[model samples]
Target: MRSGTDVAYDDVNELIATATRLMQKDAAPDTLTPDDVRKIGEELDIPARYVDQALEALARRREEQAREAQVQERHARLRRVRLRRSAWVGAAVLGLLAVSGLVVRNGLTSTLSDVARQRAQVRNVVERRESLRARQDTLTPGLSRDAELSGADNRVAIEQRRYDERAADYNASAASFPTGWVVRLTGLPHVLPLSSEVSTW
Candidate 1:
């Protein structure tokens, strides 16, 4: 017959949930160190081999995530370079056209000003989202995982979605026809240009 240590968990979430329930029943400490973790595993009838396997899986996941981040950063840089080149070339053409009165500078200038305003709005939304995310992280260990944490998470998601929408609106205006070239020329960020345009705070 299988022992209690033979507990089968399909995923990390299941393992955490099982462990948490057991710990709560045992009246374990709120905080736990590495040794505490191992001890708890023993008390919970969790196999040492499973713990090692979980650690290995976690390490591999982190490494994969790091590599993914590097790739995103590289792609973002490449996009910026390509955009810079195009924007500068367009700016030169615009300057010549403006000088010869072929293109009305006032109309384009007004559009660029509007794009800058949209960019400012995106930044404000990003600030609020980040602040909420920080609080969520702080409360992860002991906070009620139900309504309060979910509410905070929902708020963050909403802000992030709002940021994405506003950024898309800005990028659409900035990337269309002559406005994109002008916006970049005026030193405005693309703000989620490509779907994979990764950015860090």
Candidate 2:
């Protein structure tokens, strides 16, 4: 078995130079002579049998180098494919994030719109209460102690005033209740209209 030390021992550059000279000489138009091989073997200080082995080893090495270069080129192509696939994956992730962000923004906008509608409805109820109270005030007459003592109708008027005031408070609460949330959260009847019948004190 060739250890790392044995593998590194051969001077590849010198061997290649020697092989090139031998090939050029043999390939001349003239026929190879035994003297040529003898001279090369003596000059390189190698046996004739070892020289033949070296030539075969050189051919095998050249073939291995070609195969290694092909493998390296294939690895480079695979790396490029992987890089392109990664870029596409990154883009897909970014697109998904953008879509998710838009969805969240739309949800927030809808929530804000719902809140605004509820606020507007509550404000409308408050304004209506104010108007109703103003009207009720005109109907209620202020009574001094002398007027209170003077008539039974005045006592009836005072009792009627209390009823209207209580009814107005309920009407205000019913009108201002948030229709969407309240209907789902609690089951309740609508406020009935006020009565115009005179009260008997």
Query: Number of clashes in model 1?
Result: 1
Model 1 bad stretches (over 4 Å): 1-33, 96-201
lDDT of 2 by residue, 25-51 (tens): 888857445557657897988788876
TM-score, per-candidate, Cα-based: 0.32, 0.45
Which 10-residue window in model 1 sums to the lowest lDDT? 192-201
Q: Per the 3 Å backbone cut-off, how many clashing residue pairs does candidate 2 have? A: 0
lDDT of 1: 0.65
Deviation of model 1 at 57, angstroms: 0.3
lDDT of 1 at 7: 46
Question: Please, what is the whole-model Cα lDDT of each candidate in the order they appear?
Answer: 0.65, 0.57
lDDT of 1 by residue, 109-201 (tens): 554465455555545655765676677676656456456556655664565555566556666765676665655566656545422353532
The segments of candidate 2 whose C-alpha lies over 4 angstroms from its true place after superposition are 1-39, 141-201
